[model samples]
Target: MNEKVSSSIPEAEAVIDTTPDNGQEGRIIMPEAERARISKESKKEEAWYSGEPFSSWEEVEVAVNEGLLVPVADSDHYKVSANAVEGGRYLTPVAKKMLDLVAGEWSKKMKKKGEDIDSLFLIVTSMTRIVSYQDGLSKKGFPTADSSNPRKSTHLRGGTFDLAFKWLKENRSVAYKILLEVLRDLHKKEQINLIEETTIGVLHVCVNPDKAKRRSSSRRLAGTGSAKR
Candidate 1:
């Protein structure tokens, strides 16, 4: 994977690229204030990898407090514009990266299909979860296949997230094909383990935490190298 040049915020985020341009080496020139801001916000709270799943949200909180959980975001790829089933957007950093790339490809595909792409976005139904949240959903008779065991759940590991496919099917069928195409690409790359949950009408995307770790590590190394001028 190509290394990243910088960090994030939202649509205004900038990523550096050191490739030569017009016979000159590429340079990154962020305003001093912006650079400082990026440095401050980009400081990772912790370096975390998925491990034993927790039996409850309480346990999840313990790990979070210990700097063992990396927060995800509602970035450009899988946006939480509406129809959100969860409160926050949090995934393992690797999973987030995978989502951004694959989802961007999906958007392109939608445009090729002659679909209106100006304001299209996916509805995120679920992201990182705790055992208590799973239980609550189960009690409400939500259609998830046995999330009682943390180890067995990709959600707990921050390896899995869900897209509200049913919402698209009912409200935006034109984009459905694009979503599938993106999923196919992701699966082929071995970057995700996906399941089209017919019962719940959602698409689950699971990241291999180990793979994500390697990918994120490489990005950091590339960033550090590029920052050397």
Candidate 2:
């Protein structure tokens, strides 16, 4: 197949081999082993900072602090905001740690993709924060659409941040692999959950509290949606 750009040959190439197989007379087959190796190596060599062997967000922060990580926003970009996305506001000490880690991962990932890491924007949601269950709702089933409560409010009671994936897609394809990679990473940590609302296009992640409290009397009545609930 043709390459996506005029760069290196993509591993998905179907090269025509003319080497005659001594055992098969006139029959010839492509080097399947070599092809498979290329495919495997490409994944190991994928261009994303987080995919790097030893990279982390701390390293990326050095670059950010040195007046880097500031690139122009695309016309379609809508991630910039006053609170979380712009000034990095309302972040607790613990939330900052997770933000650092997340930023480092994004930095390395962008480096791998041969993309500029400086240009990405952050939102308050990027910081992991506490999500408040509705005053009376639980996880088993959320309040019906007709219920008095339409949306459960989230706050940074201690630590947790929601990340805006929609912001990343402003100028890029919504299906960009990097965004999905970050999402899966957070999900694995069990520190984050994808929001149920399609319109939000964000990830909800929070730091695990050292000493968390649970209100069972109110929690069990409603199915617990959060890990602590």
Candidate 3:
């Protein structure tokens, strides 16, 4: 009998030290003030890209079908969780492009380190979410932002994603460091906004809309097509 492939990836045992002081050197920490500022800025950008918040899963599907939101699947550098796909596996074009750029840079860095890039991939734990799902999570004490307030969560706008850090730290320690380096570089360039959600053990990332627009325009002017889903 043939074995069926599991939809979910199994998390590796916690081999790496989880202590706060262990491997703390050169770690990127986003200050609370910076996170607050970025949160506001990201909300504005999200509003610009996704007009009204998705109130239901049907609305999310409609947006996907209409191309307002693009589906993100497993790729060479990243893997979307089964739960993320089932909840809402979509993002704005600019956000998706940003994700690709981050993952691509991390892959390059991993290759330079002589690591097996194929074995290292970022695990996306969450993506765009409908209001109902968000509410459900909130009720379950999942630390979800307020779903009633459209400006509260970028995930509602399909412009944010959560990367599972605990799994990466325990399983792919080197890749996790490289990933942080890539994120730090991008954040310095003001190309993205990041929030380290310690309570959730995930890094929440939001792409900067202005930078994405500028890059898209530059590409067009250079006769290069815009990034596709």
Please report, as a residue range, the 10-residue window in candidate 2 with the lowest summed lDDT: 45-54
- Write the residue-wise lDDT of candidate 3 on 39-146 in tens digits: 454443343333445788888787777666788998987887654648488887778888898889988988788767545567787888876776665553344333
Model 3 lDDT on a 0 to 1 scale: 0.63
Give a tens-digit lDDT track for model 1, residues 82-157. 3333433466566766677667887787767667655456656667676666666545434343324323355655
TM-scores of all predicted structures: 0.60, 0.41, 0.71
Cα deviation in Å at residue 165, candidate 1?
1.2
User: Relative to the unseen true structure, what is the C-alpha lDDT of residue 30 in candidate 2, on a scale of 0 to 100?
Assistant: 30
- Report lDDT (CA) for all predictions: 0.51, 0.35, 0.63
Where does candidate 1 clash, by residue pair? 72-91
Which 10 consecutive residues of model 1 have the lowest summed lDDT?
11-20
Off by over 4 Å in 2: 1-80, 83-88, 125-156, 174-176, 210-229
**Per-residue accuracy of model 2 over 1-229 as CA lDDT, tens digit each:** 1112221112101111112334754433334453343234222111111111112334334433543222222122123233333322333343445556565666566567676434343343333112233222223222111223212222213233555544345444422356567656765554443332223344444443221232112221112333432
**Residue ranges of candidate 1 with Cα displaced over 4 Å:** 1-50, 55-68, 81-88, 145-151, 211-229
